[model samples]
Target: MSRPSENGLSSETLFFTATWNGDSTRCVARLAPAVEAVPVFPAYDLRAQFEIMRLAREKAGIPAPRTLWFEPDPAPLGTPFFVMERADGQVPPDVMPYTFGGWLHDASPAEQRRLQDASVGILAALHQTAFTAEELAPLGEAGLRAHVAAQRAYYAWAHGRRPIPLLERAFAWLEEHWPDEPGPDVLSWGDARIGNMMFRDFTPVAVLDWEMAAVGPRELDLSWMIFLHRFFQDITTGAGLPGLPGFMRREDVCATYRELTGYEPRDLDFYELYAALRHGIIMARVWQRRIHFGEQPMPDDPDDLVLHRATIEELLAGYEPAS
Candidate 1:
């Protein structure tokens, strides 16, 4: 898959899936200049992702993809990108929610339990592994305040594109109910859903997607794991399917995480709300992209873009979403 770069150097493109020993492998390259969408954050540091994966694999003993090389200059592939040895496994498709129909849905309840446990185990291992302050400095200071500040910047990034009343109200609720004291800082996988992980035979092969990687409380990742499953379940149930019930339940996830890490997860109610608010903002940006492409007309209700608008509204109202 090697091709000539602009400067006539050999550049390789790691296709999403390849084969080795007759088994599927993904030697992936995360290319930048991401599709012409509204920006999520101010910028993406490509080197940071490569560095984070390298450190997680070497020091934390985590199953992370091995980074090959990082080319900061975009000339090589017309955009800045880095290459890595993609670990083996299949990810539940995002476009078609996994619960809608997939190997996950057809898997026996027992087999699905194995997948859920393995994914939670990875998060526990990450939170338990200690890193020097110098190593995590790139993630910025550790605290809920720092975490919210970054999101605030993102909200500003999406300001005035289209009015999203839900996001505005969610932000206000967060400020009013800010945690009395921030939880202890640990390795927080910013986007910690199971979808971001690579699994083989229902066990995690490698933890992928570190774009939202940060230094914050363990709850940041923990809450996302719980909420994302609930998110998909919401959609599946609405469409009248069982949708992998009994998997990644809130009580089971909390108990498993506490059992594996020897630390109790706190303020999950708050964190789940945080996850919804953060996701709401990101969904707004996605809508902006739709508008840009003329794919969807301007939504009359900004909450229209948020798939879990009902769930989000429930959280803000201090009521748990229906099971």
Candidate 2:
């Protein structure tokens, strides 16, 4: 047993590298949030994520890491665990962010462009996956509306009494401008950012993290990837660093996806705001959890709990996709 360098691991998981019978293994031993278990996932059955990865790998031919076994019995490790083959590659770090400076930062713009296009290609292929009704059932109530409602439920659970007005306002904004045609629902990789994927030679070799997988409009995943990259890039440059400005532009991303899938991405203003709102809710929860652990203080303004308060305001102001 070994622990990988602690630099870039997911905060929500405890991981260990092990030998999987014969294949080298990376075991996802537990989901340990600071305050509570993720409300979206069920306690009894972890079948949803395992099956999602299988469908992506076997049917869609995506590079999702192959999960080996699941031991739902908590007696083994004090928490239920699963083992899967460890993927080898570099992942963009969420802490400092790859946009600040690193291997990906050192890569030429051409290589970065190659990585960008290839990453979106995974989403294009992922949407093509034929999911069973059983699969969709596990992903919460059907429809995009349900997805938003799930977020609302999660916020109520996460915040307890200290409601984030910014998040609530964003939710109201969503209600006011709901898409007339949200388009057909597809398999949306809920956390569809390059940061969740492992890349080799500027291409994705292993798509990691399916915790947020869902059945929704194609734009759900598309906007998530675009908004997250922009989120990091905005933060990096705000601190006087030269973030990857040319990468992951909304127009460029939509064009690439349209070229591959033959459907123009629509209602992205709604989805991207939805994406930021979703992230704001999560970030606010993370802050409140830190207070729970005495790692941080309760802020004077509750909206301050959300790291991207200004971004949420700007998004609320309204966005017109770059021409």
Candidate 3:
């Protein structure tokens, strides 16, 4: 629904400003309609997304973009959209990935450590935020069981006709190795990754993108943060570039998280694998969109559509504890 604007990138989100009295007053994000035939995830709700952002900023004390208003009527823009205050800062680029070489990669070890710790602190704070049962109702159910159920629904929606065998096997693996006792759930910033955050002075100024926001185990967010960085690092290294290899290592993230919040991180391997599975579903949907638009051809093997098919293969090959 949102068109290309001078302020922001051309994606499901757009940025614009209100000009009054010959001066621009404030910048706002128009959470636009997704062009895909169906959302990457089946549970895409605008009201829930808006309320999640609002609660993260106000209730949880996390640095999230403040949502101003929502217009449910699609008559104005052909689709319902919500306007949110824009946060200004640098985003670690996905195209040239920070690990490939960027301000984050160029920073000193201490600065990198500071950034990593503060980012994890966002998770700690959000997980610690106390909310009423009424507020939690709209959000996804607690723990990994609910997450698996939702993902099953998503994969079902995403993989209707041309099925991806790799994803099916990954689901089977998850069922076989389900954790004995999953941790308690919290207000997980569903899309918890550095690229979703705007950073100033290596600290998170604002957290953006809460469409994936839900109530799940703390590892849901922590593992996502860890996996995304590893994904970038893998891409960087694959291209024969020295990436931020030591940055955001799983052990380091776990240690930092444990120190910040008294809760010790548990079942990280399970969660990181889960993160990869979730991301694989998203990437597969992206490929489907690309194929629909003639951006790319459908591969002979559907698993090739998944960028990290190897990750799924390796994950399925065995389950190992982090050293």
Candidate 4:
């Protein structure tokens, strides 16, 4: 096996590529070094997240990227970094060769449907994992409430400067209709969306990006996946991807979920509303962070703004006041 490189280092290295030895053999790794200049958040603890996900994947019997090593603080690489085994495949619903553009067009309808179904199957398996109350004690009611509060605070901070009426209304609504019982918490890949999975021949080989992995309501993952599909549909339609099947329209995805878990999705409209708000908040933060970094030429597309605004409206529409 080839030895890993300990070459150049920087104060805030955001990108680096290297090869390292793993338990099995050699593997390639990429590092998204620390952003010391920017504000840090709970989810920034990538190392802790990797460990959580590593254990969750093993327990759930899911194929995921192997996390070889990680550090929480800046030290050897002048920032926190983790090495992981790279999976060979393509990110679905992406604009890459195997996804959008002419690639999806070349593929038969069945092939496209298969890929979509596989994506849903991955979520089913994730949500179906059996985790004990003792094991999930760390992520009990307090943790769930904190998570929700943090999200609300993060979005408030991001939108505080601009004060979008729709966003404020959505945030208020989310607080009002917060689930009475979010159901027994399960291991949730907080960002369980198609873009985070690798696919080969219309099948998911590995799920990636567990930075937000945590014990949460199973509906959290489901909502994230569905909302992502909606986002892709919007983007594909905007880009003129003709004949592209709606990523979340097929009932087979939901059917498979019910069959695998023996639990039909309840209050989907509520969760979908929350999902949209969550997505919009995240995106808004991304844009805000970009501005903070002096990255100009922000998205000027009115339609993009409309999509986010519409998401906020949907959240408000689904809001039911607390009794």
Model 2 regions more than 4 Å off: 4-45, 319-323
Give the residue spans of candidate 1 off by over 4 A. 1-26, 34-40, 319-323
In model 3, how many backbone clashes occur? 0
TM-score of each: 0.89, 0.91, 0.92, 0.78
Rank candidates, lDDT, best first: 3, 2, 1, 4
**Worst window of 10 by summed lDDT in candidate 4:** 4-13
Between candidates 1 and 4, the one scoring higher on lDDT is 1
Ranking by TM-score: 3, 2, 1, 4
lDDT: the better of candidates 2 and 3? 3
Give candidate 1's error at residue 311 in angstroms. Answer: 1.0
lDDT of 2 by residue, 233-300 (tens): 98998899989999999999999999888889998889999999988877786676578768889999
* Tens-digit per-residue lDDT, 157-222, candidate 1: 775655678878888877777778667898787888888777889988878778788889888998
lDDT at position 140, candidate 2: 70
Q: What's the TM for model 2?
A: 0.91
**Cα lDDT, all candidates:** 0.79, 0.81, 0.81, 0.63
Off by over 4 Å in 4: 1-33, 36-43, 93-102, 132-144, 176-181, 239-243, 293-307, 314-323
lDDT of 3 by residue, 1-323 (tens): 23432222323666677776897635565545465544455544777788888887898888998788887887887767788777788788787788988798889999999899999999999999998778877785777787889888888888768889998888887887888988887888888988888889999999977778778788999999999998888888888998998999999999988988898888877888899999998889878878887888999999998998887788767684556
Measured by TM-score, the strongest candidate is: 3
TM-score of 3: 0.92
State which candidate, 1 or 4, has the greater TM-score: 1
Off by over 4 Å in 3: 1-11, 19-24, 32-39, 320-323
